[model samples]
Target: MELRYSPFDFTVHEDPYPFYARLREEAPVYHNEKDGFWALSRHADVLAAFRDDRRFSSRNGIRIEEPFWGPQAEQFFSFVAMDPPKHTRMRGLVNKAFTPRRIAALEPRLLEIARAHLEPLLEGEEFDLIDFAAKYPTDVISELVGVPESDREQVREISFAVMHAPEEGDGQMHEGSTDAMGALIGYYAQLTAERARRPQDDLLSGLLQVSENEDRLTPEEVIGVLVLLIGAGSETTMLLLGNAWHAAWKHPAERERAFAGRIEDWIEETLRYDPVSQSSPRTTTEDVELHGVTIPAGEKVLLLSGAANRDPRAFPDPDRFDLDRDTGGHLAFGNGRHHCLGAPLARLEARLALTELAATVADYEIDEAAAKRVHTSINRGFVSLPTRVTARR
Candidate 1:
């Protein structure tokens, strides 16, 4: 069979590792003439590309879909879509608000939030893990960003609409997604203005007040950051929790280890074994030659981090979901200057949420036949995992 790969292909979404494996061995510099993008699947190649920002530009954003791609990507992706200087400045201002102190302070609140969602489900015999997965991170991020509890559900719905891509489309933003993006922008614009008028002890107000000498974030930039946070911060963690749950359920021994206080290993291994973010998009800044293939300048390229994590060169027995392996350099949160800013929060949320689950639930099972996966351009995970738990005595 001819080796072909497209991020929008549903079949690829079902199991991209095989396709990624083929690309790594047969066509490390695979090009899809139909999708009009090139890909790198080798561990070393993708890692090097991530570190070579000068060569692999982020000016076109990290997604290869329409409307979200191109120069205006900053409107949605904020500093994530920018090259250095611009990216550096924007990220600097935002970092003050995203301090380690702030994140650590949220730990107590995060536990409260997790228990609030998990306790109810524990009272029942069976429930969809997605319900808890979807709600927990939305609330955690909302609480951090100062979104009113009243509006969190609405915000979650809008974020979902924005992240969702129709399984049948050609990777274009549907009208519904367009409207959701508009609505999210409008909501954040109003929130930014309100925070400016009445500063609070929250990230939104911190962003408004953060300044570096004469430089500060514009209201528009603040709004952009919020939208980026709600989308990236919320959705990715939501899927990560779901992926962690599903991974554990599939491997009972590892699941038992996770339940026996190996929470951190479980999270790290899940991240390496089956990351929620499968790929990241970049545009070439100059012609680059690799493996005797010359990729032209300004062409769209995908660094298949999903495949890289599973490379045999990087990990022995890459297919196994063992809780004991050294998952050191996985590109789950990516690499370089563009590494995910929300990584700490994402890990904290997953650790705490899963810890709470492990403490209370002795064992769990996911209805594999009933599990439904989320369809998106760059993300991979379940949207519905029908799960049943056994309470620890």
Candidate 2:
């Protein structure tokens, strides 16, 4: 069979479900010669890949393309690319801030932030949901992570530039990420220095205080943790808000059901039907066999999360958005050990954003023709989605 690459073709990005459905049937584990990578499209296969650490290693790195910063990129962003022991150690320190109770406590604050942005929209004729709705979660996450409100925009801008940087080159990709990353690293380093001088109650201070039997996180490790937390926590939430709203406007009935306090099902349905982040890459540590295909060691593997989420064998009427289907097993947050550490936080942000929007914005619609998509190998969301919304009774 000929190799099939998904992200390269703009047509596929436009409507990937049809092609994804075909992939589920023909090539659950697909090898694309064009990109020199393998893609897994079925839920079972993707989940298996996510769980099997020894066979499919993250050491070759998680990104599909080379890091813009060259070798340093791996050092700075290697948390996601690490295997057990190191993965466990790094994740343990950072995971403290994202506990269920902590995220649950954030709901009221998130709701307040959502309400604050939405109130101005009520008086205005129209506003961009991507600016307000999508931005709400970033603000909330920043606050939770101890980022000053004034610096949040700068942080988000840096993240946006790097996260949505074009796949075609690595020049601006490195420069932009390096500058933004420098700002973040400097901010955290200064913060850590201050904490050392005069400690306080915050996530950073808490991180500074954590010691793992003489394995405490170094300043560099602290920077890495903060970088990972801020970007992952904020960006994914923003995407979920944007993606969910886009899906709701596309399906009016689904929107109505969602507005009526019937959101859990619809949100999960939307995730399975149209997830924000599609694929995450992994590398093979050894030669692997899948359905008669031989994938050589040290090759890149892309786990098509969005494609697998909509696999027909797993979800009936996979292309259709049915608010009633069971979508709990979707790979929207990935699976197993490296599953999204902020899954609870991301879910809370989306649930609150979608539910609050449905309740407050009595009538709203996305400007389909004008809406733009942010193209990246990993993250998928909107660049701008001008939406018109009215206040509810």
The digit string of per-residue lDDT tens for model 1 on 35-101 reads 8999999999999999999999999997667888999999989999999999999999999889999
Q: List the residue pairs that clash in candidate 1.
A: none
Give me the runs in candidate 1 sitting further than 4 Å from their true place.
Answer: 165-167
Task: Give candidate 2's error at residue 356 in angstroms.
Answer: 2.1
Model 2, clash count?
0
Q: Judged by TM-score, which candidate is best?
A: 1
Error of 1 at 376 (Å): 1.4
- lDDT scores in order: 0.91, 0.73
Q: Which pairs of residues collide in model 2?
A: none
* Candidate that scores best on lDDT: 1
